[model samples]
Target: MNNLNKELHLTNRPVDMPTLEDFRIVEKSISELKENEVLVKTLYLSVDPYMRGRMSDAKSYIEPFQLNEKISGGAVGEVIESNSDNFKQGDIVAGMLGWSEYNVVNGHALNKINPELAPVTTSLGILGMPGLTAYFGLLDIGQPKEGETVVISGAAGAVGSIVGQIAKIKGAYVVGIAGSDDKTDYLMNELNFDKAINYKTTPNMKEALQEACPNGVDVYFENVGGEISDAVFTMLNKFARICVCGAISTYNLPSNEDIGPRIQRTLIKSSVLMKGFVVNDYAERWSEGIKQIAQWLNEGKLTYEETITEGFENIPDAFLGLFKGSNLGKQLVKIAEPTYAKL
Candidate 1:
């Protein structure tokens, strides 16, 4: 194999919405693998809403991407060269690797993937961080009960979609809020959600939400913020629980001006519990969540959808699709097909 590697680097930060010009792809030569290091050939790369925060030089839970350096995120790849005892060539693995065709990483940083368990691409979607985010956020923070009404914002997204399904598994009536009628249909018909609301078309979100959640919202999995969340807040029942996850609705806004309607009074009046969390906060119990989700997946109790964009050059386009609501479920960029042979 040639020693050339292609990678995408953050060139500039956008004041509003991100544009393709903010990133530049460059080619470099791959280096020799050292002890405890493996050379990875990326197969599937993730383009998530969270990555948008890292694009700017802002104070955040994770460090911002350095200008002119390779941007890194979740990726599933095959080992092309290994100098580590723990991994051998051709082992499929998942880790935080650079947005590149090839990456040289420490073997300890990667989790070995069993191709037979599920599709390797799932390591970047339902069976990966997004799935775990839904599990812990809903079960731990939302704490839904049987016969309760659980409302999920950004319901057609990767995380919200799973949250609604898991709520159903727990015997709660699930209501999903998506951006389009097609996405709403997917939620109601395909995922078996109790109801689905197209926020884009609905003239009165509060009235629609009130109609859908006749029992009042007992658990709200908040993935999109702004006007959608304000409406959900108005529908909260006593002792309601809210899990504040990614706020894709406000990610593109200028940091200083990113504000919304006050909800402190709503929380105080209803005795609602609202908590925000990053998925890494549950790192210690990740395996447990993965085990349960995988079981549900195998038994057909859980299912997922993927909006995969082909070719490495379309990575930025796929990522931008997240903001425009161009994807139905999990949005992924298929860079290359996996080679299932050990060297």
Candidate 2:
């Protein structure tokens, strides 16, 4: 086994949008396994927009990433060595592991993955956090009804895409708002959304939304917050529900520039229900969400897409790309190919 490993560390707190200089790759020797420890050879790792919040030292739902330490998120790997009875060589596992060529983690922190059931990458994507976020946020919060207008900002993203599909399954009239023409095409043609507006090209977002949703929006899945959300809010119907899944548009903005029209008046006038949430809020029922999403996937009722960056060294690029709308669905970094297990 190779004793030396490479790890990406946060070198500095980003001011606005992050740059490559904020991160540094450090090489170190892998320590010997202790009790209940497992040596994992990273296969694939996920890069998500939500991670942008943790880059700053401000208060958040999760802890901030300590400087000069390994950055961590969802990763899948093959176990090469294990000291615990729970795992053995060749077992594939998934967990919130460090961004590295390899990792030494406690067996309990990882969940065993069966590659035969679905692609292991899905564990970090549609079958994992993103999928669950879409499931619970849409069904539990948005609660789209039949023939209702459901509009989603960031509709081409990992969570938003799945939310749109699930809304369609519920017989809702789904309209998606994305950044590019290609993404708009993916939403309407590939995801079968009733309408898709390219916010970048659209001269009047509010007018486009008004035309697309003639009946007004009954459920609004808010992902990219800013002007896009402001447009969606204008066309919301009475008793509408707004599921606040993410605010990518505001993630990189400075405090002063993050201001927008206050939503209290709109919510009060329309009797709209707006609630923000993180996926762990539904932790008690994760299995239920995953099982239902998996069944929908298997039954051909749900589908997903991935924009995988090819190497571990490119993880930062993949993460930064999220703000630029460079990816269509889930963005991931392929760290290394599995040696102990077959895919």
TM-score winner: 2
24-80: candidate 2 lDDT, tens digit per residue? 999988988999999999999999998999999999999999999999999999999
Model 2 lDDT, residue 24, Cα: 94
Q: Over the stretch 167-258, how does candidate 1's per-residue lDDT look in tens digits? A: 99999999999999999999999999999999999999989988998899999999988889988999899999999998898899987776
Runs in model 1 lying further than 4 Å from the true structure: 340-343
lDDT of model 2, residue 93:
97
In angstroms, the error of model 2 at 255 is 2.9
Off by over 4 Å in 2: none
Query: How far is 60's C-alpha from truth in model 1 (Å)?
Result: 1.0
Candidate 1: worst-modelled 10 consecutive residues by lDDT? 334-343
